[model samples]
Target: MSLVYAKNDWYAIAAADEMTLGQQRQTLLLGTPLTVTATDEGVVVRDDQGKTYPYQIKFDHVWTALGDAPRALFDIPEGDEPGRRCVPCGVVRVKCSPLRAVENFLDIAHFPFVHTDILGAEPHTEVEPYKVEIREEQDEVWATKVRFFQPKAAKSAGSGITTEYEYRVPAPTVAVLYKTCPPKPEAQDVIAIFVQPRGEEECDVWPWMALYDDESSFEELVQFQQEIFLQDRSILENQLPHRLPLDPKMEIPTRADMTSVAYRRWLKKRGALYGAMTEVA
Candidate 1:
């Protein structure tokens, strides 16, 4: 996992709000040379060789599945309190697995079963029409779009209305999506999460929330989404492949496995496509 993480490619470190301007800190994740600096215009990432890349803190959690040991580097200024270490890069790297399994989870069809409690459709429930899009390169890398029809009375009454929760992956480990209610048909709410694979079997999960109408509302949403991530992290890390099964018998995916099935099929096709292209070339 660590080897694939390019020192040159722009990788997400932390949220912009966490670090102020003109501040530099050193971190250990992704190697000891990692350094993060905040400038007036924006943020900059510097390698050991003084090579710097200007960037924006797009995701809240810096996740990786590089090496066998997963670690998180939180940039705490030197002048903070006692027992505080300033993490220049705020790069949290965990070893969960390669980026592939993470991609499979986003398939709308899998939510109904794999993650039944938090995200899923009841048996016999038809999923609202949604499109699987592969947009621009810099577009949300890992993304999902889903919508479901729900009864209006059940929604406002806090009756756990039937709704669609769509998640889009914009990077190797970022999830961005919308959740909506009836009457107010607009998807005004968004949840963005970053999952870094630490080593080969662990992961660091960070989640942030924001409203499309009000961006600043991210403050409270951050806390709310973080808790949900905590729950997800606990379950994901415990399950095989971090909530995925290497062997089907251990966890059988049924009709609700549509999403996972689709994802697997896509991956296979991608592999074949790339393989043929390589051979032909």
Candidate 2:
């Protein structure tokens, strides 16, 4: 099996919680083994060759690159706002391509079937038309005007409501979603998925959130988000071919897949080949 990751981009290598003093851990990234150590100066990551790479801690994870990154890390404006709880939902390692995992996040039609009554239920599986465009300036894909009915959109949600949704793909292996906040209808909640590719068919996914929820405990928030992803993990790991097909003809798409189409195109246009199927079978 031959897989090529986008070498000129940033990826999350470790979580902040794992950087306890005097602690050391080993993990793989793009098929390379690295040693992660926590020291007085902060966490340091070095490869088997003893060469250490520069890293930064952001959104509760350690970000690094195997090659010289061509672009700066994307920002999360909602994360800087006041009164919003910042919850880093931790890591979920899956036996699937990082691209497939991301495409799954940008999908809403599966909520009723995969997430069940929590995110959606029977007779409410219809996904409204959404506007999708690629921001040429930033080379990002965005989808707007999305609306869906949810049984329980958030832990703070008391009942079902029509949720307003917007999706953004600022990076190939990362996706951000803006949805109606149950606690504050005027503002939206931000949920981002940052995937760290261990290889072509495996990855570590870090889910982070910036929300207006004050009622749900931190533990409850983590559990709720993890549960949602665990539900997705079932489909992610079992999907045929494992990697995401960038070719539109490989898998038929409906109107509800507008954002996914844009995402695949953006990936292709940018030449981000990590965990992507570029050729027809």
Q: After superposition, how far is residue 49 of candidate 2 from its true place, in Å?
A: 0.6
Global lDDT of each candidate: 0.42, 0.88
Model 2: CA > 4 A from native:
1-5
Residue-by-residue lDDT tens digits, candidate 2, 86-174: 99998899999999999999999999999888999999989888899999997889999999999999999999988899999988899
Pick the lDDT winner. Answer: 2
Best prediction by TM-score: 2
TM-score of 2: 0.96
**Model 1 lDDT vs. the true structure?**
0.42
Per-residue CA lDDT of model 1 for 54-122, tens digit only, reads: 444433332222223322322212213342121222223333442433544454554544444444446
Tell me how far the alpha carbon of residue 71 in candidate 1 is from the true structure, in angstroms, after superposition. Answer: 26
